[model samples]
Target chain A: MPSSATSNTNGHATSHTKALAKPTVNQTPNAWSFFAVPRPIKRIFDRFPLLTYPANRLPERVQRVKSADGHALFIWCAPEDASENRASFNPACLRWQAFLKSQNLQFHTVSSSNHASTNERLPFLVVNPSCSSPFKSNIVSAHELAKWAVDQKDSWPVELELHYEPYMSLLNNEIRRAWQYHMYLSPNFEAFTAPSYIHSQTNSSVVRITSSWELQKAAREDLMKSSPRIDVEGLYASADRAFFALDNLLKRKRRMVADVSAPSLLEATLFSYLFLLLELPLDRWLDNRLPEIARKYPELVELENTLKKQYGLQPPAIYDALTGTKDSTLNSRTRLEKHFGIR
Target chain B: MTSRLNLKIWPSGDGFPFPSLNVDCLAAIAYFQLLWRTTDNAVNWTIISDWDASQSPNGQFPVLSCSCEKEIAGILNIFQHVGSCDSINGHSDLNSWMNEDELADCTAWSSHVLTLGTQLLDLYLFITYENYYSTTRPAYTAFLPLYANYTIPPAHQKAAEKRTEHLGLATILGEIDDEPRMQPISLRTGGVDPSASASASFTEKIGFGNRKEILSKAQKRMRLESIVARFLEPLEELLGKKRYFLSNKSPSSLDALVLAYLSLILEVKVPDRWAAEIVENSKLTDWIKREAPHIYGNAPNKG
Candidate 1:
């Protein structure tokens, strides 16, 4: 019963709809109908198969599950550039899809073939850039499929959900903690670190469990909990996917290759390394550098337990020391030369 | 001389602006002070050449008096005081061979002061004289008032002006000076004939005596190669084998100072570039987060 309003900012008066009188859910209205589809999504549709793509064609590819009322989200993902085979699979898209799949609901992925991609889908979330969708930029941008959900909000049956994942460097640990401390201060949405980061410390294999009922059961049993493994997969997969996509995109265009120098590659590499480092568990790092930290940061102990349970780990060597072991006898230059083929 | 000095430093408690925060001198001072503190050595710490003299008592001691004779006198006075101090050993010369005790205890204070003070003085002189052709006149104006307050008033004032002008010319030559300046329009005032009063006065006022000879002598006196060799020897020794400066402890001010000087000097076009770089290049930047992580609101990477 949710009503929609045409954006007055653009002086467009025709598309106004009233709020849902018989509200089924507490959902925010879509404001992105006015803007163009995000650049990446547009590229996807433009490269859509000439014939209709089967709703369930890529079964393994589609990971999100349907909600209790049979509502599942969809996001359109495409290469940042045309003529590139690699798609920048956003981490959020993968997480959301995984969450949905765990719910065990029947859903459809309207791929590059779908022409009716709009933001009217109810309970259907869009992870588009904040401009073109109700969802904020932070979460969705890193996850193109999330952005697509926002871009195609009008096609779903339920309320639209928008999410924003901030750039990683923007939030330091304490600030991020403070943000989590007062998440409810904002009425519309919530924020979370990557699932892979939450799961990074443990060695558990997280098989997606579907259904709200099942999710609750798992939550009660502490079967699937916060661990760095999930975060490593989520964050690293997204960055790596994006990196490959960018790499593929750049390789195709002579202009970008000619213009982008060695520094840009190094910049990208640094970003990748920093993200990997940040995703690592502080407890493991602390154990190597200062054992006193385990006593000092109590949250780390709790986090360590959660990670151990999630990853099904029974205490392994800390990550840094594992890497540090290789460089013990051999110098860094030699190691880099041996492993990375760089001197 | 007054017996006991009670110093009230501005922006005090840990991070004070003395001896140029981005330079090696502060680190040397920190080490010396740390050593002095541990040993319970009694040293007279005074306010000298503070950027803001008005912040000090009577607004005189902190000023770097400009008169050539006065500056030279000031230099001599410090040496004389150090010589008189019971802490300093007066007998030893660099040319003589030294025993372990003599090296460690005999001239600890004087030798330390001499080595550190010489570096600072050389840096100051480099910024003031040889590099003056690239410096601006306004920045040097701070020393004017200090020069005016010296024992020999006019002489000190003139020396201050000379140093300022010398520095100004060096700055105009576009070298070590990094102070922001007004952008004047480019005009071909066409080459001024030397006979013209303006050109003649400009030459007479700005020119230094026997420039090449002075530079060669200064270079020899300072032993640039030796200092650079020593300065880089530690780093070179650790290169490719170790990461971060100082093999053991978390980065200290000394690390930042050395790194800042090298980084900043390499990128002189950026005003305060060298100073800022010293803070940026190594683990020093992250040390700020490590020591006081809450201030920046981030946990340091132990990895």
Candidate 2:
């Protein structure tokens, strides 16, 4: 988390004179001056040759939507996709989507890539292209959505208790690592994740393959930080333990739901992960154990089902269908031959 | 079936617990202490102060060479192996006594502490420039053999860097990620220490001389505030007014894990006391004052 603290540098006249006289501290020594270097030496080094480097001209890769619509949440998705019964395929995006629905914040989903958001991640909410309002900002990025949602809701009945962050850390580290491993590093990457996130972005085989490899590599590197390798048993077992803990919490207290019936961020968070795990198309998920792990906790499955019923946002992806393998009538060799126009 | 049990763990100093230097090993030690008490000393084990992890099952310790000729590594597996012994009557783990929920929470919190809490320790011990030079590095010498000492601490610090790189805390912690490893430390001593000495407020900014330095100082403080809140506040909440983390009556595996972290943060004599200063005021201080001596025995004289 970057701190928003801005430092006020008030310059003094005396200090300015001192700074001008001195060679300056905390900077590279100029060839002329020796101590912080002396001001005379600094003046001498000021004549040294300077080189200029090219300023970065690379265009922003993100989707730029100019609030042409009211309350559109930009997320990673395919085109012509309606978000009915379709939860976001991305857990980060899905969490907010569920939260928005649970909070009854009126918004339509826009299928935008991660590049569209200022944070370089997705699920940013854009408010009021149709109207100008001082009450709300133009864009609410992913992390800011919770506070943003609160403002959108005139009354938040319950305050987030202290236990929220710690327990959330449980999912953030344990379950997230497992999810990353499953989606990007697991055997399912070639079949399911690649086709869904990377292949769907472009028809170019080179772009798709390269992006897929980079994505998997990044995931592998991330996983390797806490684990020796993609330790399947260890990651899954940790996630299972986390699920079991969440299950117990759900049973003991309705932390996920703020009121007796009003769902909170907790439900949104747990539901997004559970939905991805349980509802992800199984055939495309080779050697996948996340769904199996999540299913052990009845509460998790119930949460997913309830959230799906309320939000009606199941991820609009059947990976097999997305990749045109929904016609299981043809075997792999025939499918390849058909793809290439071979008789 | 008469093979004696031997646990190879990271070595620590004489005054602190035997396996105190590493938090994971400390947790394992606490579990062993519990097993010893629960089973009435029926199960005995030896602690081999080993520096090498290459032979360990999971490439780390506490590797327990059990009587059944099985070499088990990782704290949880070690707990399972010992708890399953006939002496303990097949509890299977120290956490097995917990109800399903408590047991699950114990496991989850353990994972939480191991990753995030351990990163905090990494930041405190390995990342901070002065603390690493003046405190943590020398401590490594007391724990490892000479040649091993030279190679090990750097490797360990490098791992810590890789582990928490995503946090983007290097600059805040006074470490520059891309700079040559030693260059930053030497340069920081010259630049940061003078400001800190001039100001003489150890808890405050290292120095905010210029606009860039002022911004860096503000960022450092902000990052510090957030990290302490994110990691420690919940721990404080969970442990509010309790003797142990889960129960008022007895200590659980969770206590052992918490003990591992708290003892290091509070007891380790780091020059950079920013992290400890924040946690010191929290409920953790009271818990440590009450429970640490009971678990790990008295602290060694700093003198």
Candidate 3:
């Protein structure tokens, strides 16, 4: 609980007094505000739901529909997408969406761009927004979404998290670099990633081109942090090796979507990366070796195949693309995944 | 093959300090040493401890410049280059004999060490307040020129800051810094401050009265344990009863990677040695004692 000073009074009213008290040289309150910050300046106070933000209004609201549902998850969804049945095309949002589904939480994924999130990244959950007063913070960052999910549940997949951190390094380093390299830096960017992330959000040619350049530049700068230049071959080789290692580990899973009790958070992450690698048109580039490497593992493909239906994650077009009229059954079981492992 | 292979890295400090203070550079040297052991020194590689890292492709140290191939930077790239050259004579790449499963396990564990293991080492050597300032900072003076030493050590520390920002360890590191400074009222000064203590009860003046301080101290211990445990526990579980990580007969790339980080933590004498203490008591201690000397080669100058 907050101390009495904070608890006893309305936070906003008390906050103005605190802000006024901050400087030693007391002057007129209106004197020295920066010309740039844009009026009514938001402030965070030491009270429950500390952040105070300006509400999104007018023209922006027309394109982006705000769900009044307290459990609405704002994600890196397409700007027009509203259906709960469709999966989030973006991997970052889909990870959380998959996790929430596994936890049996009924959240409607909101169609949002990166700017919709509190931290200006996608996949932030709006927690009880209806009860929140105007301009009061109600959004939970993607970083804190897992904590929120865990807090709500009585039973958790504790055993699956046994050695998650080390396994996490596999996903964070090798697989992540490969994914970034393919999506942003490779020829696949123009064919697939640009359509999904960049073109879908904007229309002006200048915005599309510059945003594409800026996004790829950011990925390049991050890649260059660990090396002198992007070693494309090295990255693909690492991802291949990572896939094989994950395949070795994935042999333990009988099914997906928390698997009756396994809630590793690693599962959600693996699913997101594997789903995109297997399902998306990332192989548009000649060097797009990730999809092939991802397919070599049967367990990985199986995990994505089962988890999609378990979570209702097939986003219509992808569902059609995946189950293309080749409805052939295996020795006994009928396969939902028709495109993968066809080497 | 006749001409010497020049591998440049950051030089060792005097009097048995590491061959390189940096983990990647250290691992790079250990990698070559392993290659020489298995290949009967066919590669003719020389470890040149040069301060100038500007010449390399990556603009970083631990670069391999050979007469036959283009100079490559980074440990893995260098390993790749050497692996490419393995077919010459009877020289075979390390782990070339292993089946697909073993090779995959080796790569996975090595990746683990390079990622999470690097973070843990950074937390210990560079990120912590007391250890960097008191010990690791001054130790750099012996290896680097005066101006470069000041610039380079801090660059490592700053990079460590960026690397570890995601781990949520800053608060615990802050508490750990305040541990020594949180002396009792009587102990901090020659005795209790008379003016300050006058308002307090008898128990408050003598010290041990601050429940908040005691509580934070306990909390700090648990947080520190948990933070280090997240990195080390899986490693401990993996290393149990095996002579090497996932192997018994011969050391692979994973062994070299783990040993590179392990030797530094055990050897580098830092004032706040909590991390080192944990490693000393871990499952890998015997493995370290036996393998470190053989791989690093006791004489830093000999390589």
Candidate 4:
């Protein structure tokens, strides 16, 4: 029996241990060690494989599956249609899916909402054991997922890497501000993004409204990090400047190179932002700005189309449903088919 | 009928008995000690340094569990609870020094100290990586098992980061997510030594990858200094040459609160000396020393 002193009110033994034991600054405990079997325990299991009933039951080369619900890599991403072709409507989730696709990694995507994730953020990846290893099964979300990808040797080229930080900052800061303003701060947040994304997740209208409010507040706070207050026109102008620089870079690269089929990490980052920005059903004033900006630079549109074709991503059907031009139910079914690769 | 009152606080380091590394824990202790000194209530307090805050009423430390099965968490709430019970009687009414206007002044100052003062302390102790890893975190994790020493500090640090973020200071300091990888000598340096001449030359060597990082860090440092200055201005002005804040005769709960923070700030050896410098430059250190015997039995000669 486990020690009673180790039992926390939350019923999590780990927390109880955390409360009892003091942490030192010397060494951070290996996260993998938490899942590693002790030498003695491993010996006991090795001596009698039958006694290790679960271990004996696991299929060959699928060692990680039995440890935690049987999978090499389990991704909790936003709901996608049947063929799993169209990227997630959530920009963050779409970014992860695109990143994974770019890396040519095979993984299972579990359709989940933000609430399902450990950090209440979507596009979390759970890495399971492929074979016996000291590293435990790890669940990485947000930027940590990107870090994990880098650890796996899926990194940008040196030229792209040099520009990666500033570009990422640009995306996370300026481009993100514009995208968030369009999605949440703008009028379309309530009419489109909130209802389709946030409202569908929860039953309570209060939660939907409050969650939207909170998200918008967070976006505003993020914007305010650079400046004391929000400047709508200034934000759009800064966003336009960022787009122009990116457009010029892509245009120059396209013109200079004979065959530039390989997508840069910069392109992936830009596509993540633009894909969401272009596909979302925003109010006319907010919606027209991005397309107008994109129309000025054919390179951006070409890149978007290339990414869409590469990923087999379909046009988001939520737009037609929101506009009341098509039956939402039928649109959703077709989307599901397209996403899941159904007949 | 006398009710039993049990005060649970985070344990102090071996040498530092009454003065806990945590400002909140120290404040809670100071509040309780003030109650004991002025009131007829018999309080039995336990120093449970490894106490699980999640088990408390408010998911924080310094919980006051009364015989009535009422568990009050947070220093202010516990103080209010004790006051409302009429446990603090006779000379214990420190508020008697203030007239209506003075009382309002006292309360305003108290609120300011609680909010801005606490934020300043949070920045000094937790938000800054050096102070956190070196002093605050080690003190809390000192008595715990080896495994726990690794897990608990990060958890507490994460919470502190969140608290600072909510207060909007995290933006100026850069998000916790953006904190540099913990360097072995980081705690030793105490978060970019203000006096270090090396930082000037170091910026040149930052390379292309970390150019943005270096710039933001400098920006954060400047903003933090301004914020610290802002928090100090009111306190410095209010306590100018006064025997105690808002009262000439005796120390009030406001005094206790301020002293709790001041004493902790003065005592802890952190990288940012702004708070310590403020305490040294003002009469607050003298006041803390003067009130030390009443709070800690005997005033500690050294921090």
Give lDDT per model, in order.
Answer: 0.29, 0.69, 0.69, 0.60
Residues A61-118 of candidate 1: C-alpha lDDT, one tens digit per residue: 2333321123324432321211221111222232343323323333333222122234
Residue A198 lDDT (model 4): 63
lDDT of 3 by residue, A1-343 (tens): 6787676555545445645545422254543333222223422322234467898666754334354444777776554465555677677888888888888887776778877655689888776545545774667788887777777786666443434565677788889988899878887676556656776666677898899999999888777656555767667777877788777666644433334345457878889988877765432333558898898899789888888777767652433433343432231112222221111
Residue A167's lDDT within candidate 2 is: 63
Fnat values, one per model, are 0.00, 0.38, 0.40, 0.00
Where is model 4 chain A poorest over a 10-residue stretch in terms of lDDT?
A23-32
Candidate 2 chain B least-lDDT 10 residues: B177-186
Q: Cα lDDT for residue B169, model 1? A: 31
Instruction: Provide the clash count, candidate 1.
Output: 77
**DockQ of all predictions against the true structure, Cα-based:** 0.02, 0.27, 0.29, 0.01
Off by over 4 Å in 4: A1-83, A128-134, A151-158, A255-259, A280-287, A323-343, B1-303
Candidate 3, residue A74: the lDDT equals 78
lDDT of 4 by residue, A147-261 (tens): 7667776465333322334445456555776777777777666545665566555667678678888878887766544333455655565466557656766665666665666
Looking at candidate 1, what is the lDDT of residue B245?
A: 36
Residue A127, candidate 1: Cα error in Å is 78
Give the winner by lDDT: 1 or 3. Answer: 3
TM-score of 4: 0.42
lDDT of 4 by residue, B127-225 (tens): 766566656776766765677778766766665565468456655433443455443334566675544435644765775556777797677667766
Q: What is the TM-score of chain A in candidate 2?
A: 0.71
